[model samples]
Target: MKTILVIGTYDTKDDELHYICQRIADMGGQVLSMDVSVLGDPSAPTDLSKHQVAEAGGASIRQAIDAGDENAAMQIMARGAAALTAQLYADGKIDGMLALGGTMGTDLALDCAQALPLGVPKYVVSTVSFSPLIPADRLAPDIQMILWAGGLYGLNSVCKSSLSQAAGAVLGAAMAVEAPVSTRPVIGMTSLGSSCLKYMKHLRDPLQERGFEVAVFHATGMGGMAFESLAQQGYFAAVMDFALPELGNLMVGSVVHSGPERLTRAGAAGTPQIVAPGCADLVDYAGWQDIPAAYTDRPFHAHNRLIKSAALSGDERRALVRDIVARLERANAPVHVLMPKGGVEEWDREGGEAHDPQALAAMADEMEKTVKAPLGLTMLDAHINDAAFADAALAVLDGWIADGTVKLG
Candidate 1:
């Protein structure tokens, strides 16, 4: 029998959740309501009591609720709910999950829903659904439904229609989910077109050989954000950032800014990381036609007919170094920042049109000065594509692996 796991703070959202559960049961679907409230008792009866859910979450539910404020209690209850849901699914009990709430309830419910593996349809009906801040809709590879403008106990007609539609959608999705055959840890690689193939050749295969499935993301503004989001989603065990061209775009007011939290996710999540200066020296523009007047005199290299690259100037290089170091400094997990001194981009290499020794030196000096973390700094005197550069990166990773800086599992 397919059991639909309906989760909510029964104490706070009893009326709405009870309404949804009744509809699910009436639709001939098995409904299991899981109460996620740290404080008061649930208004609706549930398959799993608050104490049970808290136990499943590896915490004392009653204690957490009594000790914390409303916000803190919600966070605690969300963790418990997610842990309980994960256990239920692992035990082959939950077939699907549905959540109904405004922003706070939506946040807690989705936190639990995401615990289900990809393809297990998760739905959130929220009033804030129209102005969705949840990136799960856009980012997660999983199919997440966000039903907008879900009113509170509205006119019977409107409420019935919306609830019926949402319930049916969630039920259908749960029935269709394919069972996961494996739970391979995803490795996210941030690359540019110029260096993507190289990642496959040098890093991806090596990582797979060491038992990891690789997912490569472009270093464009959107691509970097998506890759980091996946890391925060706990979808990736490690991050290999090979193309960092977005730094130059961010500094130059280009359309390619990767936002403020570009390289900071893995560190915050304690995901093992390998950072690089790959494509760090240049910024790509639409074409030579869009090059700023001040940069018109600088050397330019045509990557293709449509894209042109220009190496950073001395001051820009220094700023890039500081930004890069700041990110590296914040990492709590095993981190290694490798600098390919021969050049950070193809054009900056010897005999390339965008080569600028002055800019390169300034960048390196800033790194030496700014990156004072013991053993965090790895300056390799080789071209990025050189076998030596690859060897150095692998060596740093291997050292971290041996030293237990990164969890071997």
Candidate 2:
């Protein structure tokens, strides 16, 4: 039977926790309840009490209860829960995990969820699943969350339905997930839909033929974050970072900023990386989101109901190029910057709405002037999506692989 860890501040969420525990049991799963409450006694029976959890975080239970500071107490419990959760997973006692909470509970649960490695099932039922209050950098790359609607304080019909779904989801994941088998070294690539699909198509087969697995990440804000996180974790043998719209988003103070350290991780990890200024010409926002006042007059394109993009001005493009140069300067590994002179995106070609050769030229000029070794800079006559650009990028990566600068499995 799958052992799913149930986490919560049982002092306040006892009934909800008990209901989910029973639901998981009904589904033929075992429960390992961990109580994280700091103040009052737990209403439900717990296998691991708050006292143990508090001590795990380096504090005594009595000290936590007497502190009378909710924030401080929650932070303490969160640290303890994270350490205990990792230990449980390491011991093969936790197959999956589910937690329910408002703010404090969600905070502690997120800590525990992040402590578990990727591919382990992690779910959080929270009233504030994707709220702005939760810092994006603190979230695990693959955490799944259900917005707990009308499921606070006690077990109502709505609460039961949500809880049952959480139980089923976690249990099903635990039963179905198989251990990952070792494979050829993975080459991490980033791109966007339609805008840079041609480059990805050209690179994938060639990289595979050269004995490396290609893993592509879409360059939405979160996609960039995940790619950076995985790179920092040493998950990729090399990286072909083609899409950079997230940087443009960050440049203009858009809501879609990938964390502050987006482009620097692969270099910090000493992973060979071939960087391209693909899709750096635009910033993306939700289709329903209003254009920021500063960018109101910029050229705009609505790709679909879910995505809208705006072209960057010459000044904005220069700022982005400088940012790229600054990041490349810090590389501890082999880095190459490929400049596509024709255009950077599908809409950036001649006769297109985003066409601006002068702006593209400015970016290339800035890179030439500012970027230095251990960064190599190359300017190509082809568009970013063209076969020529893909061939150039692959050749650079192939050279590194052949010279033992990048080792393949």
The clash numbers for all candidates, in the given order, read 0, 0
Candidate 2 colliding pairs = none
Candidate 2 per-residue lDDT over residues 1-409, each given as its tens digit: 9999999988888888988999999989999999998877776569989998999999977878677888888888999999999999999999989988998899989999888877899999998988867765567777889888887777799878888899999999999987544489999999999644468888888889999888888788778877888888778899999899898888877667677898999989888889988889888887778888877777778888878888888778888988987887787889999998888888988888778888888877776777777788888989988899999998899899889989986
lDDT of 1 at 406: 52
lDDT of 1 at 363: 82
TM-score of 2: 0.95
TM-score of each: 0.59, 0.95
